[model samples]
Target: MQAAPTPVLLSSTPIDLSPWLSALDSVSAAIGDIPALLSLAVEAGRTWPQPGGGRTVVLWELLASVSAIDVAAARVLEPHLDAVAILSQSAQAFPDIRPGAEGAGDEAWGVFAAEAPGTRLEARSAGTGTVISGTKPWCSLAGSLDSAVITANTDDGGRAAFAVSLRHPGVTCEQPEWIARGLREIPSGSVHFEHVPAVPLGGTGWYHSRPGFAWGGMGVAACWLGGAVGVARDFRTGLSAGAEGGREPDQVSLAALGEVDRTLTAVLQYLARVAARMDDGTLGSGAGQSTWSEAQRVRGTVAAAVERVLTLVGSNRGPGPLAFDERYAKRMADLALYVRQHHGARDDAQLGRLALKGDCPW
Candidate 1:
């Protein structure tokens, strides 16, 4: 008998992500149920956007959707989304590997490319294949993901990417390394690859130097912006519904609300422009702004927007929402953890250096 064909995943275009959004809401409100979380991940995988016109559209929509629900869930989902985006670009970068280019399935994907000095994952050439051995930290969904796009040091002292299966015989994932109360569901830890067989993805310097790599970094900002929006919703809802308890919101509270709206609006517009530029292929070297500089610039801007939203929400709403509303509290905490992906003053300094060289492509 012939095997059954894999069903086609839904196109995220004409994007209606209500089901997954609802799932996220349920998971966030409830105290982090593992089964529910897995179900949501599956939904996300199935609807993961393919490379096309609506890619960035689906990205912003999904980030906002997940952020509006819960950031921990966003944390779980973002890496998978990033992995897909990375692999999608890698396919073009190294067409010879024929890496799987399909959307979400039972086999989830993550990107594990964090580098540790003196502990690089060396790729050993074996016949027409390669094997990776070393420790990779900051690996999200380490044990859970079926496959991933990992980076390794090639024998020639250059870097290369590999598609490695987690279930391979020599692989071992270190559990419970991610002990933070926020984003606790995302098991970001270390994974040990001991002679794990793999398929090479791209050549030396390709993974970091690619234009899409920077574009993908900016995609992360979209998720952070969405999470901030999610947290700000509590403030919006509460202020509009009257003040905490029964008191009317004062001028101070109203001012805070204004700032929240302005911050989110600016960040949202910036994200839209960046996404459009990315889709139109105008976010590159000759476009007057290198993708790397553009990504850093936007990431920094969105990161600041996230801070402003959090500050405004906290100061305006006070602690009532944080103490009483479980969802609001979780989102606030989650957003706090997620935005730390930005490097703060260091990133700002890098942008300053880039600006001194030439005009930035915004």
Candidate 2:
């Protein structure tokens, strides 16, 4: 029989895929259902934005997509983490899959699906004159990842990014001993590197130098939205039970659930509107401002509101080991911590710029 050709993936332009790479880095055993995405495809996660266009909603679109990717990656790597050569092949798999982030930092990229916050990932100069190393936190799929998109202070004092495999020399992983309570599934550890060979990305600070990087940076809202949605679903389960038998639900629980529904809805709408604008390129300069307000910066507002609902139900829903019972309590902890995962200080600065008069205030 003739040899069969392997199918190849192709796209028109080079894109920054660090976002999705971040997703691949997050999948793990904790990832709920890997095949569920295929059987019950999520409309929101399927279509990512292309250069000039994409999906209609903005909130956590990337994060949600990545979260899904985590599920997929988990399906592939969780059982194989103990395999040695498996890690090498895993690193090789990433450069091909996330082709869009060809030149991203090695910190964000991972060769395997597993790793650490300060995991050192380095490569010998293929004599390609490349060197890479650095520290990266939030490496969700650290122990399983194959490589990393890293940033470091270069020899000349400027910053640089490169791709490196964890199996390479000089790479080390600093696993976070304690994982955050909420979003407990995302295993963001650490990575570190020392004199690792690397292929330099375009230049230093490439993380934010590109256009739309701001829009690209904080799309983590979608994952937040997913967890929020999950929380709401869990809450709804509680509410339905609490309202069972027409026994008159408690007023405080009812009221709290209502507010959680209301606030999350508003935030999701904000995400949808801004995302549409971004897709059509119709978003004005202030788009960043609006997105920040809804998607992040003030994400604490959503977090706080969600917290209110969870606390209300957890404390009053009548304890047990059922799904809507004690399990819901865990999600409460997850959301509480997960909600605060974004770059709050930076988002605050952006929001601050709009609130106060600055030299280039919007």
Candidate 3:
């Protein structure tokens, strides 16, 4: 058999992740506090890393931080980091696309561009600018974020991306529509835009077509992996504390821990490989193929790892943590909610189809 083509790397260098890791550590204690989470997010934005930083560095740091912090806090903060990641790349990829002060942020930002059925944001030309009108659903941190990168349907039947201030006129953020008892800090719901003025960032289709878009998808996986880590750590701590009391840790607990460690170790290696490929601009870039597939694979793997960790932790520890441990209960709730971002069988089917088409030739 002919050897498969080796993926090429545009650059090779280890990413320095100390700065972002330290920043996240400084705020780790406050992660469970909703108000503090939002505040620290903005504070991080104010000192967001400059250009010339490698992609892996940003992604690794984000993953490490999210792993150490609460999942609810990760939900609130990850999108903001995603916003910066998106706009930062856009600013580099497209010279005309420059972020305003708010987008540059002394405050929080979100990418409110999920175009699900029944919800729409229409973009219309207004004088020299554009105005957006309609309801945008699943807008996380809608009321709290200072600004957002909104995707709206244009007159040409194509979608375009814009940077809009959340506090601007004609924008109405509604009460959170979440019924789940988790990720309460992220008040995601509908936001109505009635002629809300917006500045165009990139032309039609630029948002989805950019390689950085797929790169940002990996960032989401980083957060998922982090949540899994958080779950694993909670179980490990409990196991350790139990053992410290003089009795041997149960075999069931040990087996669960072993499985968790193995799964997480595999995930960590996968993440590192993807990060390196991402840093070199190869993992998710192609001429005609969808870049999103790479990130989707990572997301799928991490989601599975998270599920495994949750199951093992619950089965091994039973209801002790759930009934008495506040932090553990919260972590479980938050992670359960967050990992649902994966579309289950549907996503798997899509990935299978992609594989069949040779988009993934491993």
lDDT of each: 0.72, 0.45, 0.74
TM-scores of the models, in the order given: 0.86, 0.62, 0.89
lDDT of 3 by residue, 255-288 (tens): 8899999998898788777777665766645643
56-150: candidate 1 lDDT, tens digit per residue = 75666666666566677666666666766667677776676757655335666788888756566888988777888988888887777788889
Give the worst 10-residue stretch by lDDT in candidate 3: 3-12
Clashing pairs in 3: none
Sorted on lDDT, highest at the top, how do the candidates line up?
Answer: 3, 1, 2
What's model 1's lDDT at 25? 49
Backbone steric clashes in candidate 2, count: 57
Q: Which scores better on lDDT, 1 or 3?
A: 3
* Candidate 3 ranges with C-alpha deviation above 4 Å: 1-17, 46-58, 101-103, 285-290
**Which has the greatest lDDT?**
3
TM-score of 2: 0.62
Backbone clashes counted, model 3: 0
Q: How close is candidate 3 to the true structure, as a TM-score?
A: 0.89
- Per-residue accuracy of model 2 over 48-90 as CA lDDT, tens digit each: 3432236434224444433333323322232121121122222
TM-score winner between 2 and 3, please give it. 3
lDDT of 2 at 113: 25
